[model samples]
Target chain A: MTPIELRCCGQGGQGVIMTGMVVGKAAAIYEDRHATLVQSFGPEARGSTCSAQVMISDAPVPFPYVRHADILVAFSQSAYDKFVAELKPGATLIYESDLLSLDNRLPQGVVARGIGATRIATEVLGRRIVTNMVMLGFLVKQTGIVSKEAAIEALRTLVPPGTSAFNIKAFETGYQQPPE
Target chain B: MTKREAQPLRTGLHFMNGNEACAEGAIAAGCRFVAGYPITPSTEVVEHLARRFPRIGGMFIQMEDEIASSICFQGAVWAGHKAMTVTSGPGLSLMMEHIGFAAMTETPSVFINVQRAGPSTGLPTAAAQGDIMQVRWGSHGDYAIIALCPSSPQECFDLTIEAFNLAERYRCPTFLMMDETVGHMMGKVRIPDAADLTVEPRRNTTRAPGDYQPYATYDGSDVPEMTRAGDGHAIHVTGLTHNEKGYPDMSFAVHDALVRRLQRKVHTHTSELFRLEADGLDDADVVVVAFGITAGIAAYAVTQARALGRRVGLLRLITLWPFDEARIRTLTANARAVIVAEMNLGQVCLQVSRAVQGRIPVHHIGNPGGPVIEPEEILAAIEGAAT
Candidate 1:
């Protein structure tokens, strides 16, 4: 792939930074590519909006910051609203359908798709915290930026021990969801 | 000691952030003592050290404040441990007195300053190269220091080991001046096995207990031999100007000779510590001098400028302190202009200007702190310098 800049944003406790870390590790460590991850350094502990920027490339990534995101993965209405303006024209946006109500006033030429990630995690996986991993599964299937094997391997190392099976099931459920 | 016996930590490829990589580098270099209070950006270094030190028979202490943290590491050094302290701008400010003390006593230690926006608690969450000058002159007096800047996570791991090696080799304090961006950013790092690394052992005095003079150099070397506190050597370490006995000597001659030796030890041996990355300097009309994060940006700008048929090159300073004057003078002597790009307001630019000495036009592109300098802005500077 050429260089791709992605931003995953959400509220403080929504695992936005962890999603970025998994994707970056998948690319840099497992896929034999280059990736750089930088997170927002704001007061994120107070449940404020936070983001993590991940840049993936076949070569070394020169700059770590995301000036304009090619792909934006938002998990909340506030995150989508705040970051919608920074997406490049014709950019792809993946968001949680249960959390965000899509507005018709999105930036011109932007392609947005929604998945009920939180619903799948809670109802099917019996956990609400696995929504980010569910979204990561959907992200891998939708964007094709990282291979499924690489993503799954990255998830194994990133998640807590003995819980990888549950998270992988949540991810597969999200990946099998139809586009809305 | 034999090279095989010096190996300490296992090495492998890992995806880690710069701060964690720095902590691993210290462990691989056999650093056994670390003391620091948590701060923004730099807190991860201490966090990683706290977790790993216990496993390796090392000590990690979260001191009450940066003042105590700074001196605590020096005390550990005197007790025959390779010591380090990690902090940000505010904590670095508080550690200045101890840094000066370390310099005066010729204490072998390392200080990792993950710089943030500041004059006084400025943007704590953002990155900045504002502490470049402070690391060189923040501590009072005329003593010289060794400072290294890393541009990437791999360099963060590699240069940190080099920082500890330089500290032990010279028996002086060394600074690993990293910025918030490089400290917190994540990238791929490949760590070589300890057997593949050349670790510098401390220059301990070989003389018998009664014959040892702590500050005396017997072999015409400027660097003095060190002895630990419990080594049965009658060593007296003081911040005051002392003679070869390591005691306070008030005479002007003693003070002059001592101070000169302290500065000369680093100054005369700068070639041993000098490190930089240069590109396209053979026939370039414009040169960009940058360090740390700005160097990565400037390097990209140089490549872009070259593609546009402009004769631009980059002089990235990996070692910042004993400022590479000889190389800078030679590289910029015949160039049309030189551009110094940093996050601070022309701090290193002043050094570049002095090195150029009216031989070429020196332009500065700087930000006070916070936001990073974009590559397009550096390209503009390169084009302008070409004109």
Candidate 2:
């Protein structure tokens, strides 16, 4: 892909930054491409809005900030509301269907899909904390920005050692979900 | 010894942020002492060092304040250890006095200033290149310093090693001027085996106790060989103007010689320390000059400007200090204008203007601090400068 900018936004404790890091690592380390991730958060430790911007490209990813996201994956209602307008026209947006409601204000010509990422993680994976992983899996599957094996390898390195198997299962489940 | 003689390093492609990579670079460079207090954007450098240093037989101290931290590393340096301190703008401001002290006593140490927005306590979470002048001139002195700016995580790792080498080579404080964006950005860093990297060892005096002069240069070299504080060499170090015997001379001749040597050491080595990445400069009408994170954005802007059939080039300053005045003069001589892009209110622009000597206009694209200067803004500046 020609330099694609991706942004993931959620609450502070929702692993937004980790998701961005994993995707960036998958492309940069495993896929032999270039990626840069920049994270932003506030003083509030747990519930504050947090976002991670990742740019993946065949060439060096300079200008690290996401000016207008080519792809946005948001996991909270507040995050979705805050960042939806920053999407480029005809950009792809993926949000948690169970956590966020779409408004009429999404930019024109935007292609958006919603997945019940939190629900799937809580019910199928038995852990709601891996919702970010599920969303990341869904993002990789839909966009094909990174290979599934590459994403799984990144998870193996990033996630806590003892819980890798469980997180990988959540990722696979989310990867199989049909986009809506 | 060269890097080829060191132990094997974790040499492979790894994904890490600039701060974490800096910690790894320090370890690979054989830096054993890190003293720093936690601050926004720069705290990760200490955090990673804290976790890694202990396992590798190094020491990481979270000092009570920036002042204590800055001096703490100098103490380690005197005791024969490679040392560094990490901080952001306000903390760097607090360490300025000690940085001067490091220069005065010829302490070989490194200071990693992951710059954020600030004169005092400005935006702690945002990126800024505002500390460019501060790192150079904040300390009260007529002394020169070696300051390196890294625009990526890989350079963060590579140049941290270079910072240590330069500090030891010149026996003065070296600055790694990073910004919030590069500090937090994650990317692939290919760390080679330690045996393959070039690491400079600290130069210690081989003179006998009676013959050693802590500030002496009997060999005519500007840098005196440093003897450890407790190395049985009757060495005395003080911030005051001292003679070759390391005793305070309080005389005009001694002070002039001491101060001039301190500045001359870095000045004479400008050819070795002044590093820049010049692209499209051989045939260009307008050139963009930038350092730190702004340099990365300027590169992209130069690419876009070139695509639009504009003869715009980029001169990315990896070494912000020592200015590279001769290269700047030659590059701007035939250009219509030069654009100095940075995250501050025209600090580097002043340097560019001085270097250009009014032969051409020097346009500045500056951001007070919050957001980065967009590539389009620089592209527009390139268009304006081209006209």
Best by DockQ: 2
Q: DockQ for all models, in order? A: 0.66, 0.71
Candidate 1 collision pairs: none
The pairs that clash in candidate 2 are B3-B195
List interface RMSDs for the candidates, in order. 1.4, 1.4
> For model 1, how does the per-residue alpha-carbon lDDT over B1-387 read when each residue is reduced to its tens digit?
212323347577778888988998898887989999999879999999887777678889999999999999999999998899999999999999998999999999899999999988899888999988888898888898999999888889999999999998777779998998899889989899777887888888889998989999877889888898998999898999998999899999998998888899898988767788888988899999998888878887898899999998889899998887777898777689999999999998998899888888899998988988999999999988787
Q: Where does the lowest 10-residue lDDT sum fall in candidate 1 chain B?
A: B1-10
How do the residues B36-80 of candidate 2 rate in per-residue lDDT, one tens digit apiece? 999988988999988777666788999999999999999999989
Per-model TM against the reference: 0.94, 0.95
Worst 10 residues of 2 chain A by lDDT: A41-50
Each model's number of backbone clashes?
A: 0, 1
Provide a comma-separated list of chain B TM-scores, one per candidate. Answer: 0.97, 0.97
